[model samples]
Target: MRVTELSFEGFRNLHPGRWNPDGGVNILYGDNAQGKTNLLEACWLFTGGRSFRGAKDSELVQFGADYAKLGMTFEAGGREQEATITIRQRRSVTLNGVSLPSSAKLAGTFCGVVFSPAHLSLIKDGPEGRRRFIDSAYCQLKPAYVGALTDYQKALTQRNAFLKQSKELGRCDSELLDLWDHTLAASAARLTAARQRYIHRLQPIAAEIYNGLSSGREDFAIGWDSPIAEAILPEMAAQWLDALRQARRADLAVGFSTAGPHREDLTVTIQGQAAKAYGSQGQQRSAVLALKLAEATLLQEVTGEKPVAFLDDVMSELDTSRQDYILNHIEGWQVFITCCEPSTALKNTAAKVFSVKQGVINE
Candidate 1:
């Protein structure tokens, strides 16, 4: 999927602007703290109806403003689409000019790959972030995956509530707890299996891209830390139910449910050592970039569609060869890049360059 045009209003420091991007490389260059990143963030909202920077929907509205609006046109498989999203303090969202009943209603329409400086922490950060990273990327490829995730989260919440309440009373509603246990375990098993399958498919691609970026100095590997692998989803579900029953007392004492896909993690290794502990800063950045690029490739393979790339200050963080690799090797996929200063990094390519300053742009 490629964004052909974008329009934003009252979003962050951006005033209002309409953009037509190159299908290859589209660069938005400006000084630091300008509205460049805000522009890219608006585009990301169309993909998942959420901010990649972890900002709340209302937070996207400009200071002293009450609302923000986003309208984007994209092309997928030679078909064109126009989507609009409106954000307000206490209001619903409109998709395609109609009101969406829930945020979950905004899934699977657009696919994108976003990069920022914060992604460098993917290797070092806690497991929750990494799981979200993988889950979000894979969810775009399969809508069912998103549905499964939603179900799992709902079940997890119910289970946790049961455990919390049971612990507070010093006695449990065994019947209700049993129902939630089975529900949570079943949903967790499905989620774990999907995650494992994705990791298995993603590892080789990530390894190849990482090797290219690191000049084979690092051997990168990725694995899912799930109790059950791809071979047995149902059996694992049954096992998890048993485990949940056995751990009920401890769970109640802690006032929370534990040990399921909600607590699962992704393990990254470099040269057979844990990257979280052993990899250098530069290695983590390269590995994360490779992982993202692999995600773009995986999306293409699954959907026969290439996701548009919205890179936020990513090139600035990479070495010369890796930067060159991204600029030179990227194919027909549309890319929106934000950089603080102009450089010869993109001079060799044909691009549509926009100068941004103080939320205004000269195209």
Candidate 2:
């Protein structure tokens, strides 16, 4: 898929900006914080209806403004499509003038994969960040996985509230808690299975990329760490429900449910060592890049369309070999890459270049 044209109104520092991008590499060069990332974020919002920088809908609006809007025209499978997003206190998003019932429904239709400086923390941060990384990848390839995760999170919230109330009452609402557990476990099991399947598909691709980047010096592995493993969906649901019951007293004392997919993690290793703890800074960056490229390939396999890539000043972090790998490997893909200066490396690669200065993009 390729974004042909993008327009922004009252979005961040960009004011009524519009551009038609080339299918190949598109470079946006500027000093720090000069609306370069803003343009990419606008594209991302059009695709997925959320701020990649972790901003809420209200925060996407320009200062002193109440709303923000992003519109994009793109091509997928030789057909043109239009997507638009409007941000106020709540975000309203649509595709081809048709309203989607929820963000989960909107996720994979015109999806894009992004790699930014902040993603370096994926390997070292808490489990929540890693979980989000997996969820984002899954959402881009499997819309049903996104819906399952939404239902799982909702069930978790309801279950937690019931557990808190039961603990406060000093008597067990065992029946209600059981009901919540059943629902939570059912949803959680499906989510866990989806996550595990994604990781399984990603493993070989990531390993190959990591090996190439590391010059065969390191071997990489990715694993899913969920409790309900090697079981059918119904059986896994029953197993988790029983586990919750077994942990009831401990959960009550802690005032939370502690034995579900929420406690799971994704572990990455290099040469039999934990990537987060033992790998060097360079190694961590390479692993993150490999993980992202693997995600893009998996999305392509699942959707039969090459997803757009947003690279936020990530080229400077890699050495010559890794940089060349990225620029050369992603041949038939749409890339929006931010740089401080237009490098000779990009001059030969970029299909379009836009100069960004003080919130303005000059085409």
TM-score for all models, in order of appearance: 0.90, 0.90
Instruction: List runs of model 1 lying over 4 Å from the truth.
Output: 90-106, 172-180
lDDT of each: 0.81, 0.83
Q: Model 1 shows how many backbone clashes?
A: 0
Please report the TM-score between candidate 2 and the true structure. 0.90
Q: How do the residues 1-363 of candidate 1 rate in per-residue lDDT, one tens digit apiece?
A: 788888888889987878777777889999899889888888888765567777877788899888888788888657887777778865355666677776556556677788888777788889988999889877777767978999988998888887888778889888988899999889888887888888989999999988888777778999998665455878879978977888787888998886788778999998999988988877888778888999988988888887888888887767777777777546688888888775676756687898888998777
Residue 270 in model 1: lDDT: 88
RMSD of each: 2.5, 2.5
- Cα error, candidate 2, residue 37 (Å): 0.8
Instruction: Report the poorest 10 consecutive residues by lDDT, candidate 2.
Output: 100-109
**C-alpha-based local distance difference test score of model 2:** 0.83
